[model samples]
Target chain A: MFKRLFDWLRQPLGLIAVGIVLLTVFSLAAYGIFLTQQSSAQPIQFPHRTHVGFGIQCLYCHPGAARGPSAGIPSQAKCWGCHQQIAKTQTSALLAPLKQAVESGTPIQWVPVAMVPDFVQFNHRAHVAAGQNCEDCHGDMTLVTIAENPQVFNMGWCLDCHRKAAGEDEAKLLKLADCGTCHY
Target chain B: MNSKIPEIKLSEEQTGKWGMVIDQDICTGCQACVAACAMENNLSFVGEVDAGYGRSMHWIRIERFWEGEYPEVKMTPGQPMMCQQCGSAPCEPVCPAFATVHSQAEQLNLQVYNRCVGTRYCANNCPYQVRSFNWRDYVRPEPLPNQLNPDVTVRRMGVMEKCTFCIQRIHKAEDKAKSEGRELTDGEFTTACAQACPANAITFGRIDQPESLVSQLIRKHGHGVKHLEELGTLPSVTYFKGG
Candidate 1:
């Protein structure tokens, strides 16, 4: 009677255990996909609308975009370069917080919008020279109000642009997966 | 995986292969290339102690290969050397995980640090002794983080990193070319070393292109030899002796 009970428990119960493991894995995968779709988080809602409508080009804020590896962020001094002469005091609620940071010689702690992983090399100089419009990679900022995560700066996205530019020839030109192309 | 498959396309039969001609005569050994490479590739530098322990990470190192006796002896300047990205690479097969592979384009060896488990099998097999290991995490001080190139990834600790021939810059240039709907012209995309060379000693371009500046330099300078030729590494980088 004990042997009969043991056999029954092993068959059905063991099947249930396997099913549980499979379910857990699928649930985890689904969760990861859902989280990824939520997109990257942003700190401040620095709208490009107010700035661009004022006829300010991207280089006004990111001064180093054309010449250097980095597109320099606007320091408090940079903000005051215009704001001091125009709006001496905080007129809008948004500019209020930054007013002190600007007037007191402190800087706005702006968070990075596009953060590339370590081991990858990205240069604005070469990109600018290659005739890539800022909008191509950064997306259509003209239509953007808040700095939303418009660009999906993934390896596939980078590779797609490279494959299109360098030609399909893997020997003469580079592809995205070419370890040297990205890692080194 | 078919290990022998070409990673990028380039005709093997091309004569006067486009190659950098490092003029030791003009090489100041300023290490601009070294710094440019570090910032461009997200290479993390270990402190002095770690560096003394052989963990200072530098992909392209300015190796001062000296000769002659003391007193009156002169330090014959040397060029910075990195991965040759050989046609037949020693580091390629020795990698247990196949982290480093050849680019089908210019025959550049691409070192994928993410896939590397840090067995350092490639470092042991490399004849140039160019591969560097990261002993610790490095941080760019405060606002200086803004100085980092957005194109490159910052490497973490305990990973093996090496020269990628600045393929990221190459890819960026290619992207621009595609957007413009044109072929990548010679001198359009250059490695940082080539660009920062004050003496114009370093030349970079598509090796497959017959009329490229690299090909022209190889023609002008008769001595274009690989670092360790007898080892059969088939290094894409060619060395030319100075006057």
Candidate 2:
């Protein structure tokens, strides 16, 4: 039966069918990749550029960056603190979700743009303490609305910075380069 | 285990960065170390059947041997067994994925779980039988998952895990010390097993530091034995024989 199908596939009609099948597979794979790359929809727009324009520091909203592993999303109360003082909170279209969430005492579900694999234990304090700017890995937040990863947070990317920071210091290099440092 | 292999000689002063001295005489075999290890490392609890079949995921185990005849049998003092964090580990060389390797800075064997392909070759090569493979994805229902230590990775099915000597605690202590711009003071922190031991049988610290508590204890009691030392594994943990 396979031999008969192969013989038929040698003809123009069968060749077109084969081409269609191949195209479908390729397109499906491409679509899957596209979906993975696309960021998940966030509950609130939370404009980084607008806040940054008013000279509000990144640490002002997400204070955990300097203190611990996770640079946690700001609570609704924290959001309400600033938004309550603003006259635009009363009627602005983009600020409606924040007003509703704050009134209902429901937290905003933030979709983290910059995320590493669960296996890779990324520490914000270590990176922040190393003299890395918030813009370094997280990109220039002042130019964008939502947070975007500056680069792919791969092992190679981490190693490159670590190696550079270590320079000629053999002990520092060993500690930084050790697999057990970030990964348990 | 090979008999003829020579142990790698580290510096005269430094045996390893981290080390433990466990006094078997003081241990009560209460399984406190086992419980502490499980809680600290987020180790899965394999069911009774799987555990009986030697699939138990406990990192630190208390070993008590039986002596004499059936009529007058005596249980030996409890001896706690864990990953020795071997200087020249047998498991390091056998990993096809390069998942298991020696940490030069920490002077310990490290198992990179992300890199591990569940080959089980490292576990097979281990002389002390410390490494345990995750046979299945053991679920932590509801609030049990909430109790997990965020520092340690909750291993999925097929990854090989073992006692890390609480590397997470080590890192946390070191990070704290670094932030404060001071060296990590001796006895500032310890492994969960050491901290939880009611009898104070387990002493853990920087063995290289001659002044550290673990080093002082090791020196005070120099007759301690390294399990399977003849294999040239150069285990970091030292156990004093109990009467």
Candidate 3:
């Protein structure tokens, strides 16, 4: 009986089964490395709280959000529209780069941290005008000091919000997820 | 029909059937509509060679049907051909996969690309020849890539696409209207083609709304007919023909 048990555990088939389990474990770890390679995320860290806390609405920084598809980043000139006089003398770490860009009329190369795929069409005007607070899609941005990729922003995220809005009768016709709503 | 009088229908929400009226008299055939439509719809520019091969996917094109030739050639200006959201659409029935269909609330032919299998049947059946096929992925070189509308999808290869009447804009307008608790304005949700027309030839609005410009124009232009109406395409687009 002892010999038979040993044979069962030590057989080539048993060894092969053990190898398969080990391979799967290593592959999973390998997948994490793949994810890291694909997502070389390095956000420029635009401080939303700093702007918003200074009595700036979401639209102020992300101008044209109310009218067009894009919530266009305020031009460097727009930064000087306020920052020129307020922190004119202060050589704070963050303000120094921004101040130089504004003075030189050189645009700050604002890197896009939150990126959706090319196929998906997301409009800020539609969402903003639909009485949807910024928090609905963007989370409580007031709580976020620096902008980061907090949400997945995949189709599922979009669908869930749309589904919720569609279910609510008060949300109106535009809230419905007509395929053309996003696809076109 | 009294063109300016209101018509009431009670099956659904108090909605207007959005439509457009392009007056051929004013259209100069400058292809402004084509450029605007291309930009608005995220239509790919397949370069000059491919465009020559009829691979150019213009959602709205100003077709110039020459009446004469040489110095004596009197070029009668043409109207732009776009997806006519027909009341009785021909493209609706022929789709092997029901990729193109009408929405319940509005008289719009919605094209869902992910569902499309690229049979090209819809293109063949379409009399207006407005449907387009994506031959390959066309990416604008960097710096220019930043100019693309984030709200419009850049289509991939081997899928059929066409004008959704700037449905993206319509949705934006509608969402704006709902938020403000009101109906869409007369010219609030204009298509890019309509807006870009230098002649103000295109008027976009609900046909069902008798007071709307489209209905009024149709009434005056002898119920402005769709191209090949006998085929019963029931195109949403109505053209006002004049010199």
Candidate 4:
């Protein structure tokens, strides 16, 4: 029985089966890694182009940009304010979630594309007031189908901009580079 | 070698040298400041066992001492002990990772938690014994964590933490002022302890501004002194001695 098993292992058909199994395992792993690296699934397919083309400003949906630390996601009511009239036909597959949210009074939980670590105290208000546009850090959202975090907001990335700005406004930029500025 | 160290110059932009003045007369020894500081900074509450082993974390603590003898024995008023934010901080040089450094911009002794590698050298080198090291990973059980101030980071195990004069409030106030194209007004912002104090004992402000409340208080009461002035830490926090 052992002699026969050894003879079978040496066969071309057996070797081909093992090769196929290994290839499938490696390919699956690579695909899994790619998926994780790319954007995760969002609740709704939010088209920035359509809204931007319609002359809607970024702050219109994210009002907190001008007033608060966060550029917060708009409430369901805010969405329904415009969507109720524009998306009159609720039967559309894309508008289905919006309609259901409005009816159920449950807000859409959008998967956040851009996320800074908990340690970082990012103030959207300050950045906006400093003559910085959303596109500077977030890339041109109008061109993307789905919003994605284009820039990795690491310390080095932030310091690069701060170091440049320090030349013009040393006082303000010095505060920006301070550890307590963001990490406090 | 030169007999004396070179004189340090304050930059033009370094207009404000932030400092605090705690009126010992008004401090009720309630430890409200301690509770407020811990909550505001997301400081871990080590269990009784850990606390027994001197693992408790308190950015600001009330240090009480007994004075006089038997019949005339009196307990001195609790003095709030915290990071002095020393101008010549000894902890700055001992930190191998450069985690603890003096911020010229804010006149603060800042502890960069991310850069910290659990070397307790700063704590050992500190004369005031203000810095606390995390010996274990403290969990912020259940609902307690919900109340944590989002502005401050929840420090992990193997990192040293100390008083930052409520740096988050400073940043927020500064950002607000900068955005509005103005300077931060005196009494516009304060440390959490100063804010929470019922007696209004703790006064925090720019010492550079003579008109500021802290500076004025220091001027009016010429008895203000650093905890251990003999050591020459040049501590930012000045204690106003009371009878």
Query: How do the residues A1-184 of candidate 4 rate in per-residue lDDT, one tens digit apiece?
Result: 9999778867998788888999999999999999977666877788888888889999999989998799999887898888878745366788788888889999998888888887678889978887889999999987876787789889899889878867678796767778878776
lDDT for residue B14 in candidate 3, whole number 0-100: 19
List lDDT for all candidates, in order: 0.72, 0.88, 0.74, 0.86
What DockQ was computed for model 1?
Answer: 0.36
lDDT (0-100) at residue A176 of candidate 2?
94
For candidate 4, list the clashing residue pairs, or say none.
none
Error of 1 at B28 (Å): 3.0
Q: What digit string (tens of lDDT, one per residue) describes model 3 on residues A1-184?
A: 9998778869999788888999999999999887864523323356677677778888777867787667776777887777668754356765777767767777788767566666666777777776787666666677675565556797777877777767756334453656666666
Highest lDDT scorer: 2
* lDDT string, candidate 1, A10-119, tens digits: 89787788789999999999999999765344334666877888899998789677766678777777777787787634587767757878667666677677667766
Docking class of 2: medium
TM-score of each: 0.61, 0.89, 0.69, 0.89
In DockQ terms, which candidate is top? Answer: 2
Q: lDDT tens string, model 1, B1-243?
A: 657854544423332233455776778889888887777766665768877787788888888755777666777676778777667778888888877776665467767778788888889988888988766677667776777766665666666777767767767777677657798888887888888778776777766676887777767776666576666565667667665
Listed models, DockQ each: 0.36, 0.70, 0.36, 0.61
Candidate 4 Cα misplacement greater than 4 A, ranges: A1-33, A87-89, B1-16
Please provide, for model 2 over A47-109, each residue's C-alpha lDDT reduced to its tens digit, 9 standing for 90 to 100.
Answer: 789899999998998899998888999998998888899998989998898999898988888
Poorest stretch of ten by lDDT in candidate 4 chain B: B7-16
Ranking by DockQ: 2, 4, 3, 1
